[model samples]
Target: MASNLTIGQRIAWYRRRRGLSQEVLAGLVGRTTDWLSKVENDRISLDRLSVIKSIANALDVSLGDLLAEPSLFEWSDDRGSHSIPALRAALTDYRQLSPMAVRIGQEEPPSSAGLASEIAEVWKAYQSSLYTKVVERLPVLLAEAHHAERFSHGDARHAALGVLGQVYHAAASILTKVGEADLAWIAAERGLAYAQESRSQVVTVSLLRSVTHALLANGRYDAAIQLTSDAAALLDDDLPKATPDLLSVYGTLFLAGSMAAARAEDRATTRAFLAEAQESATRLGTDANHAWTAFGPTNVAIHRVATAIELGDIQVAIDIGPKLDTSALPIERRVRHALAVAHALSLWNRTDEALATLLDAEKMAPEQVRYHYLGRQLVLSWIRRQKGKPSFQLTDLARRLRIV
Candidate 1:
């Protein structure tokens, strides 16, 4: 039942369910009844994300609901979705309460160093765009990190707590990617609690970034921007003695804020945030992935592209996005930048080039392209615009993404 409807049809369904008149819905989205009538009848296409987001907001539905994302999640090949339940269980596991509940194992928890190494492996998998692998690894890793935090002592206990915070950060990151922003928020809040308990400023700042991301994903743009700004301000006093990891996280915070500002259409604020990030990038002096941030000069540039796209500066996105050398970045960042470029190209009406860019990205990270909203939206838009049957390549990609 979910597979056959276009986005317009879905919108109509939701609008009817809410008992909204076309006049009321159109007014809510700042459009006329005639325009919305066309939209509901599939005579118009929602080519811009901002517009679609506005409609989704007006209809009181998530962007994913409008896009029919549940069907994609239910598809057999979406391995990331398959692990979400287990990961949720791990997050809620009662054994983390220690003496209050039955312990699951007799063996002592891994040492701080061992836990760090294991957590780093999960980050590595995530950076490589191996979402399924990361999701699969997180549940047990989460349980073990909790055990380590509970059993270890003194400095070892603090270190274990920091590792536990990082484990939750990873959980939040993966959940956000899979469109489970609410779950990501829960993971991030839990991580921040552990981070504060560990008394590590760096871990706290890093987890704040995760929290900011979750906020942005949930469309709390102003809250996300404020969080980034507040977090960035806290670090400024320590800037004189800041390490590379600290600088990386600091810069990435601004990068995230810049995105939030752009989404809010606050051009001046967006530019200001980008400049702040650029300063950090310049201080870092190279393309580095300190603290798994992938934050550096190159990443700064990538965010510029992303922000430009959000602000409807398609020319700016196309100008810098396609020309940048992101080879030094992680596969996840590289593929993400590629999708940004593809989005810009599609908006510029360079459909062939957009398809080529997406094809190239699919080769690099099939799961990333298939699961990413931009890629899926672009494919759907192109298919809808085709006067006749779409090319076999386009159809195949759509089928694989389960969005046809």
Candidate 2:
């Protein structure tokens, strides 16, 4: 019975199932009964992750149960139909359990240089928001990275391990983007393990950001914050001599921390994390994408807007979001920032502008606009609110996103 319902309906269903009235559930989540009634009636959209998570908690339900997100692969093009399954196979490959088996190198292991080149290509595709390309390439890359790590010797082996770590990091990132939170957690942990094995402090710390993201996806915001704080602290002693890449990684951790803190609704901690990230960005003094971190003043500014949106400061986000230029950032970052701006506009009841912003983002990264929860929820909310016939633009966007 719950399988064919919208999130709001499912919430109402679970509320009734738990023998709880609207008032009781509303009080549990710190919302007025009127607000809950709007939610249950689908008059209001639970678009914010933090708010949705709180409601899920109050209902004693998993976030996934509440959201019922479809697998990214299920709706992807034919070329990517098997990507998720292949990636799962690679991640859970039995050969990884037997170092002896993996070291045999059934095929010649890619050289450390070759692995690095391959990783760079995948990262470029990912940052460009070419998610389909990234998904298709990663399964093979994961298999080869493991082979390289197992087959090499000494320095080469360590380099291979670092490459392996990076491969896992990419897997984790894409998994999270696609709503495969559990798989993302596994990939991130595996990345950290390989990074530590290589004894690369910078890679290890950067991979912690991946783990933190995976944790955030699973609604473990406090854990994400603590992990980010500890990881950022580890970089302090080396700051003076740190390479740009290391500093990028360091600053990125704080940005991630800011996000986690914001999601947790800890305004003070969020501000502190943002301040630390800003300091690191100031020291760097320019926008850069070292270590694929994309950390710098502009990126920090983007996070500031994002965190404000998360903290329910729509006015603040609305004020700063539209004026900023994000051309220097990667397409992925640019599109995500656009989504945040659209969210702020939507919340402010500037529906036309929000719709325009989202359409512009779709032009740049249709895949992101399609798969991102914020974008999907925003469109859903707009469609739900339409009276009689919906606007052509809204209907077209909804069809493109396959959300209608």
Candidate 3:
């Protein structure tokens, strides 16, 4: 956690996270290793704002991300990460004010279309692994959504609540990625509640899959699978009769269920869900971003790779891994697929190949892979399992992630 770290400690943390030695980081910022060590150990104070900005930029984090009290893995039952506390507090504050009273607090009123576009753009940023930017934008946007909700009763109200739900859902997704599964669930449930209020099947279904993934991440396999199954049962129609949006949602549901089943080693269930997802993909045509989910033929292929890994069938995963056309996917999904392949490679003791796979993922979205708990753990495990002095590639990966 960054809460109590001094500037120097923060620098050291970031440096280690990037797998940089004092010498390496010093070189990047054009300083001596001794000088960098002194700064990291708090021997010298970083008094200039410009210097601080430079350090943060070199680390490829925002000044706020550098200085903010980010809870890397600190957990609260209802709030997993630091972000949840802010969200919970903001939500509590909003609960006290009447909806009408909240409308007056908007910084400036925006047109419905304009506000909708803003929310959409926020989602785009989020799906691209721009978590820092998302965290920066969510507060104002959620508050504005509340304001809009208070003053409108028709389609505008649905639009506003939909945005609010989506914001919470995005929060859940990022939280889950950072290892705060509990907080992720809280955010997801809040999103699902708002989805219900908006009366949007698409939103609600999307949330169901999201929460399912969170549950699966936390090792609640049965609960995860059940959530998707129950959600599917709620839909009054089958895939063939469903709208494109509904089919998309169902496709994601089955894919998530397939993951959970694979984790449970229920091969039968896994293949069943996999088949169903492919069917939904067939119905929807190639990859389509319905319900904000990049569900389609390409995603289906990606999930097959993941399921193969989960089932401990590394060869199967290797065979399917090359068929992915992730260019059509959001960066987040692309990184996920790459990491899955990396994991499979690691299982086969293909250490260099695994590192290369992870590097490819980091190239796609550095922040997403670098700070992600699973990827970090994978690299650490790689370091531990190496039979001799680590390979340069392994050391480079570790140094880049700062696990060494």
Top candidate on lDDT is 2
Residue 69 Cα positional deviation in candidate 2, in Å, after optimal superposition: 0.9
The deviation in Å at residue 286 for candidate 2 is 1.0
* lDDT (C-alpha) at residue 181 in model 3: 64
* RMSD (CA, Å), each prediction: 2.5, 2.1, 13.2
Clashes in predicted model 3: 6
> Residue 223: error of model 2 in Å?
0.5
Candidate 1 versus truth, CA RMSD in Å, comes to: 2.5
Q: lDDT rank, highest first?
A: 2, 1, 3
lDDT string, candidate 1, 1-404, tens digits: 36546778788999999999999999999899999998877667665556777888998888667765522333246453567788878888767755566366668878889889999999999999888788788998888888788787898888998999999999999888877777889999999989988988879889998999888777778898899888888877899889999989888888988888888888999999999999999999999989999999999999999988888888889889999999989999999999999888888889999999999999999888876767776787788889999999999999988876
lDDT of 1 at 227: 92
Which digits, one per residue and each the tens of the lDDT, describe model 2 over residues 160-266? Answer: 99999999999999988887888899999999999999988878987999999999888889999999878877777899888898888988998988898998999
State which candidate, 2 or 3, has the greater TM-score. Answer: 2
**Candidate 1 ranges with C-alpha deviation above 4 Å:** 1-7, 37-50, 67-82, 97-99, 102-105
Candidates 2 and 3 compared: the better one by lDDT is 2
